[model samples]
Target: MAEEEAVKLFGTWRSPFSRRVEIALKLKGVDFKYYEEDLTNKSHLLLKYNPVHKKIPVLVHNEKPIVESLVILEYIDETWKEGFPILPKDPCQRSHARFWARFLDEKCLPAIEEACLRSVDREKAVEEACELLKLLENELKDNKFFGGETIGLVDIVASVISCWLKAFQQVAGVELLTKEKLPKLCEWSDEFVSHAVIKGCLPPSDKLLASLRAHFETVASKELCT
Candidate 1:
């Protein structure tokens, strides 16, 4: 008889990166034990598994650990091979998806975070963010999702913008993603979050908002002390 494959995930609820791993695992229909790590006092298992980065969203499969959310997402897609595909099968489409996913992480997310959270030179930050978002808006033109009719790699990577951005904007009193400014992106966000797989995986909006509010307050207090 074959031995059962053991799967475990170390993550935190408030982290979008952590949420990304959960979404991928659930999407691929992989059953995994979840260990919620305290960011302030990280677990020993987390440290042991991810010695280098010491980050959350570490996926352990049959004792082999995978770090980095994007890497884990790809790993999950490749390993499972039973559920709906995460990345497109065609080489060209796969490359395009990878490019956009990287863009979401490296370019769009940072710009949006700065625009929503910046305490200095707010105008310039918002302007830059808006410009970047316009590019995304154009990319999403007329498609129900970045993955056309269904959710895919780009949508998964951009989940932070769809869900976390709302809390960020509320806490910072900034409205970076709006229906008026970027209608297509706004619509995409709405539809993205509404999906059955995504809706359950995301943190509750009210709880998330309160947490961000407390976090920003703590940061402000520390800055004032400094």
Candidate 2:
């Protein structure tokens, strides 16, 4: 790709979905311009590009818009399949990887959201979240990454869990990824965040914590009032 090849990314820094595409692009050595969208007052370009979702993390390659983080991820992998392949090539292995990725996206992510953002039953929410984390820890015990040795499809989807888990821990005043209880999971998190691409894509820890704290306070106050 030429330096002048038009590749633009519309995303929000705070969104994990957006961060996934950003990290994938960086890892694949794709040169692109990033436009941070204020979701409240979304830009005309964003709406025009992704008319369906009006969401961030829309990748424009050669002026073609690709919406949805997972879709964009697969697009990136296919477009730049030669270098830094995010999905495995083997059919059976790839299917298994996709299954785990979908599991995290569907089951694990919703559980975390309910625990941290919506559920009135805090204890039950925590228990549900812990169960999900326990499952993840068990999965990682025998593999260095979700793809065994290298970070792949499942790892990317699972990355959302780690980011939210950290922020939720701070806001919920709980420790789930403990060194003693989930040593491997904690280690996997450490390794994932330490990766150059992920490290660069993540928002500053202080900023993320402050944002999460503010959100939690607002939600808790609303619950108390009702």
Candidate 3:
């Protein structure tokens, strides 16, 4: 690829969705220009690149924009067709991978957010989130990662669980990710964050905790005033 043909990824560092794309690009040995988007004040480039969603993590490849993290990841895999493969070659396995990824995003993520944000009935929300976590634990049954021994698409998609959720819990003063409570998930978290590429992608824990704390303060203040 020529210098001008290089990939350009518009993202915010704290966003798991954005980080997913970043890690996949690094894993695939694809060089990209990372343009960190100011999510509160979204850049014109981001709007121009992904006018529809106007979301961070829009990937600009050869001036063509790809929105949505999963779509961008798939595009990267297909376009490069080299280095490590994100999705499996086997159709059945690939489908299963997609299924788990969807489950995490659709079911688990919402439950987690509810558990953290719902000050009233938060215990109930936490219980629901735990059940979802158990379902996820079952998904991880004997594998080191959701996608078997190696970290693949499902693992990449669930990076939030491994990297940021604990910090969010700390800031929110919630207890969704206790080691004794969710042993398997806890074990996976430790392993995932420690992986070479993943470690590089994760923002430092203290820095992330500070960010989450400030966010929660704003949320709490709003609730109190309202």
Candidate 3 accuracy as lDDT: 0.87
lDDT (10s digit) by residue, model 3, range 16-109: 9999999998898888889988888998899998888888889888888999888888888788887788999999998898888889889999
How far off is residue 173 in model 3, in Å? Answer: 1.6
Candidate 2: Cα lDDT at 99 = 78
Q: For each candidate, what is the lDDT?
A: 0.88, 0.82, 0.87
**TM-scores of the models, in the order given:** 0.95, 0.92, 0.96
Q: Write candidate 1's Cα lDDT for 9-96 as tens digits.
A: 9999999999998998888777788999997898899999999999988999988999999999999888888867899999999999
Ranking by lDDT: 1, 3, 2
Residue 175 Cα positional deviation in candidate 2, in Å, after optimal superposition: 2.8
Q: On TM-score, who's better, 2 or 3?
A: 3
Which residue pairs collide in model 3, if any?
none
Ten-residue segment with the worst summed lDDT in candidate 3?
A: 1-10
lDDT for 203 in candidate 1 is 97
lDDT of 2 at 167: 81
